[model samples]
Target: MKRNYNKPTQGGDVRPKKALGQHFLTDESIAARIADTLSSYKGLPVMEVGPGMGVLTKYLIASGHDVKVAEIDGESIDYLRYNYPELAGRILDADFLRLDLAAIYPDGQKFCVIGNYPYNISSQIFFHVLDYRDQVVCCSGMLQREVAERFAAAPGTKARGILSVLLQAWYDVEYLFTVDENVFNPPPKVKSGVIRMVRNGVTDLGCDERLFKSVVKTAFGQRRKTIRNSIRGMFPAGVPLPDDPLLSLRPEQLSVAQFIELTNLVGSSR
Candidate 1:
């Protein structure tokens, strides 16, 4: 079966904007796959970030879940509103990063997030996802493969850095598949990857979550240095790093649990 999505109609020319990192996805099967990945999240209010032109939105609406979209590009927003009149009040014409995530739903509403994220700001999107983990049950999206690998990379690998430890601490990250460049309208130079993140059982980090994030960022910010030397600045003046086995390893070598333990140790030192 085939579907027509965002096909330029009689007199319109909607092009991808380079400044926005908009390489519009042009493949139907991939769009369906991305939409189908959220089946387990049925009944949850769905928020699709950067819905370029309603390609995935069609399937999302057909899924019978309440769907809303946030798009920064006015042209795309105009295209969507003109084409899909059903979404009149559902579209948000604003940057996803700047939105107050807590206000996206009703009280106690847990939702799912999906998107073909802009390459440049994809990392920033994940951090926001982390910020609202309590309400985001699942997140599925497409982004640069290298970034996706960093999301799922494990300890002891070169890709295991800050994002790896921080996101994995509360979500089970899965790198679903790789998407070649040719499938998109303006094909990106690098291959794209699709990933799904399901909220894990762990709610709290058991330590200062802020401190854990600080320790991870501080250590990985200077990746070549060992934990002991890299994290010296995080400790208060005259306070030494608490004795810990992980202090001898580099940031890329420590697991999420180890990072939490290291954060607790740093807290105890002061």
Candidate 2:
């Protein structure tokens, strides 16, 4: 469903394209809440992804942090430039996933990431965040409620699966709050959820991090199967299994720590 816009755009108004998955957030309170999530990290470098119509972005700029906006939509970029003239040079006309983040900020810079993320690429965004775990101190965003819940879900629950295990291994995830379906420009079918993930103290997983990720993905690839059967390919030949109860349980039953322990055992065999 495509619709016209009537904001302060440089070239008049533009239509909200469905292909871009643009659902401009209209609630000021929700925008404030999303912005305030990064209040504790004051004066730090920050970037807001997909700042459509600058709903959440205005508050991010107002927070007085060195805020740069990564927006791919040319229409929205023009609107942001016209409405927020102060964010002139800071407006990055680039896709966030393709951005050279290190080139944007000073050397050795770590920053917070906040946005009303487009639902289509939300998971990809999280994976990109993981790639820079050392530099991204915090990520607060709005996304599909189901995905947010999955991030916050505990081990042994159905929601605890691939992303749940992988992200929890490093970041401490918190499902901050839930938002209703009526807040967007074109209301989505399902409700939205806001979640915050902060970089935890654990810099290392104490095992082969790559193997740990592989084990988690492989196990969850067949959630119903026991870890032994799921990760059969992890070892070319038969290897001694770890002396842990987790091996007998399905992938959903293992916590992040348990997965790490298993990864260490499996990695030793390989």
Candidate 3:
């Protein structure tokens, strides 16, 4: 059986905007696969970010999940509304970053997030997802391959950074597959990769969550510096640093558990 998607009516193509990072996925199979990646949590609503021209949106709709989309591009919004009428009032004309995520769903209603994310703001989007981690049960999408690797990177690898530590602390990250540039309109200079993140069972990090974030950000803010040097400012003056051997390692060398341990250590000193 063939899955058919709506195309722009003759002469009505939505022009890809460089400033908006609009590289629409043109392959049907890839779109379906990306949509299907939300397997862990189902029977909940889905909010798609930057669904330019509704390529991936079509499959989400077909999969029988209630779908809403947030798109900042005026032309893409217009195209989606005109082409995908099933969305009706669910199309949002606002930027995904500024939207109040808590208000999108009813009180305690968890939803999955999927998209062919705009490369420029992809990291920002994941941060937003982290902020709403309790409500966003699953997040899966396409992004620049390097960025995807960073999300799925392990502790000892160079790709592991602030994103890897923070996101992996709460979500199980998977690097699904790689995509070629030829599959998208206005081909990107680099290949793309898709990843899925499912919220883990951790309701709390067992330390000050706020301080945990600060520690992670501060440590990786200067990746070259050893953890001891990078996070020295987090401790108050005159407080002696702990003699833990982990402090001698670089930020990329510590796992999420090590970061939590460090956070608890910092909290104890202060």
- Local distance difference test, candidate 2: 0.85
Best by lDDT: 3
Better of 1 and 3 by TM-score: 3
Residue range 103-222, candidate 1, lDDT tens digits? 877685899999999999999999998888999999998999999999999899988878988899989999999999999889999999999999999977899988888999999999
Q: After superposition, how far is residue 66 of candidate 3 from its true place, in Å?
A: 0.6
Please list all clashing residue pairs in model 3, or write none if there are none: none
Cα lDDT of candidate 3 equals: 0.90
- Candidate 2 deviant stretches above 4 angstroms: 1-12, 240-243
> What's the count of clashing pairs in each model shown?
0, 0, 0
Tens-digit per-residue lDDT, 1-270, candidate 3: 322335557325688889998887888999999999975456999999999888899889888889999988776776787788899999988999998989989698899999999999999999999989999999999999999999999988989988999899999999999999999889999999999999999998889999999999999999999999999998899988989998999999998889999999999998
Global lDDT scores for all candidate models? 0.88, 0.85, 0.90
Pitting candidate 1 against candidate 2, the one with the higher lDDT is 1
Worst 10 residues of 1 by lDDT: 2-11
- Please provide, for model 2 over 1-270, each residue's C-alpha lDDT reduced to its tens digit, 9 standing for 90 to 100: 342434664323645778888887878999999999999998688889988778888888788877889998988877887788878898888889998676776585899888988889999888888888888899989999999999888987889889988888779999999999898878888899999999999988899888888889999998888988788788767565666677789988888888988888787786
